[model samples]
Target chain A: MTKNILIAGFGGQGVLFTGKFIAYGALIEGKELSWLPSYGPEMRGGTCNCSVIVSDEPVGSPIVNEPDVLIAMNRPSLDKFEDAVVPGGDIYIDSSLVDREVRRTDVNVHYIPATRLSTERGFDGIANMILLGSVIKGSGVIKEETIPAAMSKVVSAKRQNLFDFNIRALALGAEVLE
Target chain B: MAEKVLMKGNEAIAEAAIAAGCRHYFGYPITPQTEIAAYMAKRMPKIGGVFLQAESEVSAVNMVIGAASAGVRVMTSSSSPGISLKSEGLSYMAGCDLPALIVNVQRGGPGLGGIQPSQSDYFQATRGGGHGDYHMLVLAPNSVQEMAQLTIQGFALAEKYRMPCMLLADGTMGQMMEPVELPDSAPEMAEKPWALTGTGLSRKHNIINSLSLTPDELERWNIDRYARYAKVEADEVMYEEYLTEDADVCVVGYGIAARVARNAVNAARAKGIKAGMFRPITLWPFPKAALNKLATTCRAFISVELSMGQLIEDVELAIRCSRPVTLCNRTGGMIPSPEQVLASIEEAAAKLN
Candidate 1:
């Protein structure tokens, strides 16, 4: 099975990091994958996005035009990419920042209130991970147990102290879905 | 021992060059390819290798010429505009028969274009970006793994034929990250008998020069170089074919566009359109024989590229126009999606009727 994912938000919202977390998870699971960033002037304090593919077979195109899953962390991202979701696909939105409702009736829309949940839980600045947790639980795209090992690979030594907080964010995000 | 790690294409190419015994690197910073220079900057010093950021692309290429003339493996990397600045030095390298590696992680073209992915430099890379009848051995890598493997191969081929070799990549290939298992170590390089090592009365002093003023002597020199080029053309053509056995339509592309075209081919096959793909790995020695052979079996062809129509021209010449050929392209730093390529394939298949 192939999972085409598009993660979008503002530059400082950890949009690219969310995609990298999933890409690393897929890599740890021994799956073929690719992570391509929308890299240019837009990456500097502006809207940014990345396309990630996790597949059993070799990934063909890393640019996801019609993604199977769209993770929108802000209002602009949700409005911009909602219609591009494949029919019967899933769209995960952060309800705390994006007050707008998804107009697409053909897909499953999950609003996680990621920002409020993360802030209340004392794990601020990691709303992306909470949304990622919800996607993991709702979509089951990767094994839940594999994420910690993947996180170890992604987080550098200088930021090692934040590993525990990130793990909690993932758990809290998954709990919202439960 | 070889280990599997996730690496971006530009960083992988830099690491691979270091492992390939490339100790001297000279380049100016450019987008989509700056990671290569950055990596060399961080690691080259630890290994006692020479890494110099020249004042400009012109100076960088000339520095490579100087290093390569000293009989050591050397390299330089830049994006589209920077590469144009190095064109004059490239001609000098070819004329002097110097062995060096030049990497062009191409961005959009025609005078300071955007820093997005593009393959518009196909003509410049394959047809000798400089002047006076020369061909650089050009290798186009599609994936991150190939980014490393092909850099190693580029160095080997450059030394083997006493010519400059180009690793032609694009912004997409330079930025994407994937799992790659690198080689255990750099391969052993061959000895350079024509190197300008200072003669201490042990051997004849060697001279590396491109200024053959006499027309007759320059003509003879050009003939000798063409003979070597002919040998490389006969020997080093690399490509990949997917599902072309009984297909009526063949999709041709290279680098990232080929990856996109493969997905389109698979989609067309699901619709029973009988489509396949032919990807050229070596752009200069350009797998013309394989394309010519496939032209006999396929009914139509679609050339998918990120440029307006650079590679399609080569496709037309390769098949000798025996079959109908069409182009599906996006330029100015835009990449064509699979759906767009699939529509082109359907159109090309419909033309068969």
Candidate 2:
């Protein structure tokens, strides 16, 4: 099965990082994947997005026109990409940042107050991972157990101290979904 | 097999170049391709290689010419505008018959254009961007793995033919991430007998130059270079054919466009449209013979690209216009989605019916 995922948010929102984590998770599972981010001038303190395609077969187009899953981290992102999700697809919204309700009735909408949840849990600035946890639980796109190894690859050697904290945040988000 | 690691395309190119024995890197930073320079900057010093960030693209290409003249593997990378600036040095390198790897991770074109990925530089790369009659061995990679593999191949082919070889990729290929297992062992470097090494009074002194005062000698040099290019054309043409046999329509594309077209091909097959894909791995040698052969069987062709219609012209010429070749493209940094390409293929198929 192929899953086309689109992650969107403002700069500094870990939009690209969130996509990378999912890509790494898929890679660890020995699945074929491609992760393409929206680069260039618009990324300078503006909106940023990433398109990640994870598949059992070799991936074809890296650009996701119609996403099977959309993770919107801000109001602008939710408004911009809400309609692009396929029918009966999934949309994960960070409700703390995006106050607007999704108007579409065709897709599955899961609203998690990711930013507020991250702050209340004393793990601020990790709302992306929290949302990712919910995404894994809701969509089952990747194995939840793969998050630790995937995080280890992406978190970098110098920032190893944040490893456990990130794991905690991911688990909390997953539990919130349950 | 070596362990596979997920890496961005630009980073993969830089790492593969190092593994392939490239020790000198000189370049000016450009968007979508700056990661290569950044990677080289971080790794070169530690590995005892030289990485110089030249003040401008012109200076950087000149530095590449200098390093290559010393019989060492050298490389320089840039985007569209920077490539235009390096054209002068490129022509000089070709004239001097210097072998080096020049990477153009192309962005939108005509001018500085934009930082988004584009294949508009197809004409510029395959036709030899600089002035005069010359051609660089151009390799177009579709995936991040090919981005690494082709960089290695580019260096070897450049040295084998005594000319510059260009890895003509787009910003998409530079920025995308995929799992790539790079080569474990270093590549075999060719002997450069024409290098400008100091004579120890045991061998004749070699001159590395492009300027010949006599018109006849300059003409002779041009002719000789063309002869060598013919040999490369005969030996180095590379392309990929997908589902072309027993098909009525052939889709041709290179680099990222080919990847997009492949998805369209599969969709077309599901709709029973009898469509296939022909991807040119080498833009200069162009796989003309293979495309021409496919034209004999396929009823029509669609040239999918990120440029207005640059690749379509080549598709027509390759098949000698025996079949109707249509352009399915987007320009100015915008890429055609798989749906757009599929629509074109369907239209072509309808016309045939």
Candidate 3:
């Protein structure tokens, strides 16, 4: 089955990178995929979002009307996209910032302190990776082996050390849902 | 001999125009298509050519006009909104029968739309993009490969017709990387004997102006330019018809949209619905004859675009509205998927039944 996944958070929080890792995982798992980033002037400061589709067949609209999975790394993201979840779908939020409980009972809501955990792990900017791992743990749509390869492809030559931090973060976050 | 290289659509256009002996370029920086300007800025000076980033689109097109009047091969590029500003200069160039190339790496919208790929400029391109009763020789490339090849073609067509031709492309075509073969035997630019180069002692100076005082003289120039355009339509109608001989439906599109439509046709055929695609390589002088012929056999047409229906009008006019045509699209930089196009085809097929 095709999976529609949306990842949203403030810009520079690695929201887009996290989604890219999942998309790469899907690609490695031999799924047809498309990743579309939200285009707005406030791409850097405001709510940054990216949508990914992994499917057995060709993906239709990359813009999801009802995302099967929503990964919100901040309170605003969770509040904005909480209703976008399909009935019986799942929502994963960074609970440290989103103190309010998810009122929707139609789907599963797993709150993770993604940013806080990354900070605790001494990877100040690896929250997106943690969220990605949580999604993998939560959805199980992609194979685990592909995360590292995708993450490496995205990191610049200047920031080579990020691979270790992100991988460890993903592994720990994935362990949480289990 | 011309060589082959893998390049982005924007860069390839820059390379090809240079190879075609087009030495003057003027443009403003814009995303997705900025590579063309970047490539030119880097290379043009070394080749003893002119590459100037003008203040804006208006200044850029006008600069191109000035260079062209001086008997130089020249070009400029911009996106949709920028092209809108250049329309006035374009109309003037058309009126004066000035030969030049204008490339629009089209993006979405009526205003400063986001810098993403879009083929929404169909009407602006085909229907006298700038103004008046004039028409630009518009070429639409579906791949980075053609992006290089057609830029050369646009320059030649402009000179041949003594009018500016537009290489109409979108951001995707501008940004995508693909392999391309460069043309062999670089073309020696045609001599402009009547150009505004200061007349020597023996020759009469020719003035290149769009405004003519007398009605008769202006009418005469219009008739002559139209005659050249007619010849262009007769000789330069280019299109690619894939698996269309016995198709149940035809999807008409150009540029990146054509690529999506091709994938859609494959999906539709796999589902046992006979489908095919007619990709018009030229947006103006818009492969009308070929589409009309294909219309005789195909059940209907689905015009897949990235914006509200624009090219559909041409498809209707080309076939004289003989068959059904529908639209499948996404907007604001969104591209419709193969399945979306197939859905539209199936919906159109259903109505036929």
Candidate 4:
């Protein structure tokens, strides 16, 4: 099985970091994966996106032109990459940050109030992880059990204190799907 | 076997250079390649090594020349424009027959082009980047794993040939992350008897210079360097042939473009078209003999590239025009999708049928 994932948000929104979490989760499961970030001037407060490919076979072409799963945390990201999703694919949107509705009806769209939910749940800045949890639950691109191991690898030792908050945010986001 | 770790291609190159015993690094920061310098900056001091950020690419390459003259493993990295600035120093290093590794993580071309992935520097790299009759061993890596592996190999090859080597990668390879298994043991360093180490009263001092006044002497030096280059061409031509044994349409590409072609080849095969890929690992040597052999069986060839049509010229020459060659490419930092390449493959297949 192979999943081509695109995660997009503002520069400081942990867009690349959330993609890294998924990439590491794929690696820990012994799957072939490639992660590529959009490293242009957009990285400075503009829209930044990352492409992550997890596959049973070796990943070819790290650039994802068509995504099977897209996590768009802001309105511009959703408006930009909405039509690129394949039919029957999944798109998880941060409802608090993106006010517009997804225009496409062919793909499954899950709207989570990630930014507000994280704020209410005491983890105000980790809306990216909340969408990651929703993506994992809705798409099964990765096993939820692997998130802890993946988080430990991605979040450095200096920020180990935020580990519990990230976990709680993930749980809260996953609960939204039920 | 060592445990695998997921690392960006730039970071993997730095770690592998460290593992290969390259302790001295001098470089200028550039887009899509600054991660290598950042990584070296963080790790070098901890390991009692030198990682100097020079004032400019020119100064950085000169520093590389100095470090190489001392017979130490050294490296410098930059993007396209920065590499152009270092061309003069590159010529001097080649003329002096110094061993070092230079990485060009290429971006869009011309003057101050956009900071995006590009393979437009193929001519500049394979034709000798500076004003000299010399060739650097240019290794093109498609994956992050090969980014690590080739850095280690590039150092070894440079030392063996007593000439500079280059890792001709692009922005995509520098930015992507993949699982890589770096070697644990340090690579064996070769003895440099010709290094410019000051000798005591017991022996003669060694001098490193590229200047030769006499035309006859310079002629002989050029001849000698070409002889070594010929030996390298004969021995170090590396390539990969996938599904070409029974293919009617052959696609030629290197680096990230080759990865895109791989997917296209698979899709073409699924459509009952006999398509395959020939990826040159060493871009300088051009893998001429292997490509010539494939030309006999494969009726048509498509040169897939991230440039207008640079590699197509090499493909045509390598096959001696024996097969019909076509160009399937994108330029100015844009990459051709698999669907586009598959369409090209279908066109080649239709003509052959």
Best by DockQ: 2
For model 4, report DockQ: 0.89
Q: RMSD of candidate 4 to the true fold?
A: 1.2
- Model 4: per-residue Cα lDDT over A72-94, one tens digit each: 98999898999999999989999
Alpha carbon lDDT of each predicted model: 0.93, 0.93, 0.81, 0.93
Number of backbone clashes in candidate 2? 0
Model 3 clashing residue pairs (backbone):
B2-B184
Report backbone clashes per prediction. Answer: 0, 0, 1, 0
What DockQ results for candidate 1? Answer: 0.84
Candidate 3 wrongly placed segments (more than 4 Å): A1-8, A15-36, A50-114, A129-178, B1-24, B29-51, B71-73, B105-120, B142-149, B159-161, B170-207, B214-217, B256-267, B306-308, B327-343
DockQ: the better of candidates 1 and 3: 1
Encode model 1's per-residue lDDT on B178-257: one tens digit a residue.
Answer: 99888878877878989988898998889999997899999999999999999998999999999999989999999999
Give the clashing residue pairs of candidate 1, or none.
none
Question: Could you tell me the lDDT of residue B285 within candidate 2?
Answer: 91
What CAPRI grade goes to candidate 4? Answer: high
DockQ, cand. 3: 0.07
Model 1, position A128, has a per-residue lDDT of 92
Off by over 4 Å in 4: A157-160
Cα displacement (angstroms), candidate 1, residue A68, comes to 0.9
Candidate 1 vs 3: which has more TM-score: 1
* Model 1, docking class: high
| Whole-structure CA lDDT of model 2 | 0.93
